[model samples]
Target: MTDWWLWMYVAAMAGGVALFTRWRADPRGVPLSEYRVAIAIPFWSGLWYLVMALGGGRAEVAGHTVYWARYADWVVTAPLLLVALMLTGTHSLPGRRWRLMTALVGANVVMILSGLVADLTTDGTARYTLYAIGVLALLVVYGLVWGPLRAHARRQPAGIAAVYTEAALLLSVLWAGYPVFWILGPSGVGLLGSTTTSVLLVGLSILSKVGWSIVDLGRLRALSDRGHLTVV
Candidate 1:
């Protein structure tokens, strides 16, 4: 009956489709681990949102009807996403040390957690402080991706490199939007209505979680079809 319900419907469908496509399709040549982790984010995210959607929708925290479920989804899915990137990166850059990948994953979780704290906190100064920390941690994640991950992707074949590069860029842009929406809030910027904001937030989750998952996995499937994938 509401926009959020529709948004969740689309997200749930998209996430389910992504996983089904992954499970049903033959690997061709894509690394088994890459396929698994790439599919994992949306799989978990879909379940998270499905449960939230069924459980009376938006949640309240400190008098604000915040989308805490989305943040909780990010807590698990964000790190899983980075792991997929790292696994995909290994196709060309074989020496993708586990430590750097793990560090990025850890930093992303911290970024999400700090932002959650910022959102939950009632104190303006403390909120801003947490937001700043989250932003800094997020920047570190970008630095890791662009600096090391980019280098690794570049070393990969032209096609795999392209896919990895686009994935990295797509993730950076999409993931960055979360904080912008969080900062805007219901009383924020005055650019969007509360209902509209909720719609856009759900829309964003669908895009980042469902859309990205399907598209990136599609790329892998394409690579596999072309026999470009390595048996990692």
Candidate 2:
């Protein structure tokens, strides 16, 4: 397949990085930590997509070309995205929040790594087994977001609570589709070709990364303008 999709993803990610960075310049009452992760998601995605477009970070796995760079990007960006969502909910919470954030990050990392190994495996049994593990880890992630994280958001003021709710729900919904794409794409049953998979994956990535962040940060900005957000 042609690499034009990869190049297009690179441009999309680059635009995301620029847009988020510009939003970060006047963060108002929002914390720099939020902006830091927001900027990072697209920054890393763009960088890795650039590498993939230039014909780097690919390898033959199970007789199919695997873009390992894509996994590398996910392993980093996924956790950052999760953390950004966490920070939105827990930023104003009292006491040590790092423990929960750490747990979420760890589970997310396991999920990404499991998927990577599954992609690399040539054996059907091993591949599906790893995919199952990844799915388990993913369930844990959703549990935390919809469970404790949602509770935390509810404790916030109405506006902040609304922002967190929207962000978390949007992210969780987008994430639920990744496993389906994985199962159908080259890494699994090959029900979808690499070209179609790449298109869908890129669409998902843009929505989860750039689109989600804009919805999130924009709401936070509105809250800040209204003097409702903490000076975090």
Clashing pairs in 2: none
TM-score for all models, in order of appearance: 0.87, 0.96
lDDT of each: 0.74, 0.89
lDDT of 1 by residue, 1-232 (tens): 3446645655675555567465547766766676666666667776666766675445565556666676778898888788877766667554558888788988998899998877777777888889889989999999999898788778878888888888888988998887787677652344665566667667777777667766676787788788887665
Where is model 2 poorest over a 10-residue stretch in terms of lDDT?
A: 90-99
How do the residues 2-84 of candidate 2 rate in per-residue lDDT, one tens digit apiece? 48888888898889888878878888888888899999999999999899889998899877888889899999999999888
Off by over 4 Å in 2: none
